[model samples]
Target: MDRTYFVYMMASCRNGTLYVGMTNDLLRRAYEHREGLAPGFTAKYGLKLLVWFEQYETAHAAISAEKRIKRWRRRWKLELIEKLNPRWEDLYPGLVPGPA
Candidate 1:
C-alpha cells in the first residue's frame, strides 16, 4: 500500500503554545494528541488543536519539513498557520471519520 506522511502543527489556542510533528497517519496521530494519549510537550502544553499540516510522499520529506518548521521563529510559524487557517480553527474534526 502506498503510504503518505504529514508534517503538522498543533496549538493550545490561537497564537498559543505550538507543537510540530510528523506522522504517517495524520488522523490517528492528531486523535492521540487530542485525547492526550501521546505524552510530552503536546500534552504538557495542552497543544491539542490541529492547526496546520502539509502532506508528503516520503517520510524523509515530512521529517525535514517538521524539523524546519520547528526551528522557525514563533512569528514565522504563526504566519504560516494564519496563511492556511486564519481563524486557527481546530482541523481535527475534518480528519475524523464522521458526519461533518
Candidate 2:
C-alpha cells in the first residue's frame, strides 16, 4: 500500500530554534514532540511548533528533503518557513487527527 510521508519543520517559536525531520505520521510525530515524549534536541530546546511541512509519496524523497533541509543555512531555512508561513504560526492545530 502507498503511504504518505512528511518532511516537517518544528520550531520553538517564530524565528526561534528550528528542527527538520521526516515521518510517515506527521500528526503523531508532532504530537510526540509537543508533549516532550521523545528525548533529545527538540525536548531539550522545547521545539514544539509545527511551522512547515511538505508531503511526499515516497520515503526516499521525504528523507532526502529532510537531510537537505537539515544541512541548509539557517537563513535559507528561515526564508523557507517564511515563504509558507510568514507569521510562523503553529501548524499543529490544523494537523490534529480529529475535532479540536
Which candidate wins on lDDT?
2
Worst 10 residues of 1 by lDDT: 91-100
Residue 72, candidate 2: C-alpha displacement in angstroms: 0.7
Q: After superposition, how far is residue 80 of candidate 2 from its true place, in Å?
A: 0.4
C-alpha lDDT score of every prediction, in listed order: 0.94, 0.95
* Per-prediction tally of clashes: 0, 0
Which pairs of residues clash in candidate 2, taking residues 3 or more apart in a chain or in different chains?
A: none
Q: Which sections of candidate 2 miss by over 4 Å?
A: 98-100
lDDT of 2 at 89: 93
Task: Tell me each candidate's TM-score.
Answer: 0.95, 0.96
Regions of candidate 1 where Cα sits further than 4 Å from its true position: none
* lDDT, model 2, position 83: 97
- Minimum summed lDDT over a 10-residue window in model 2 is located at 91-100
lDDT of 1 at 27: 96
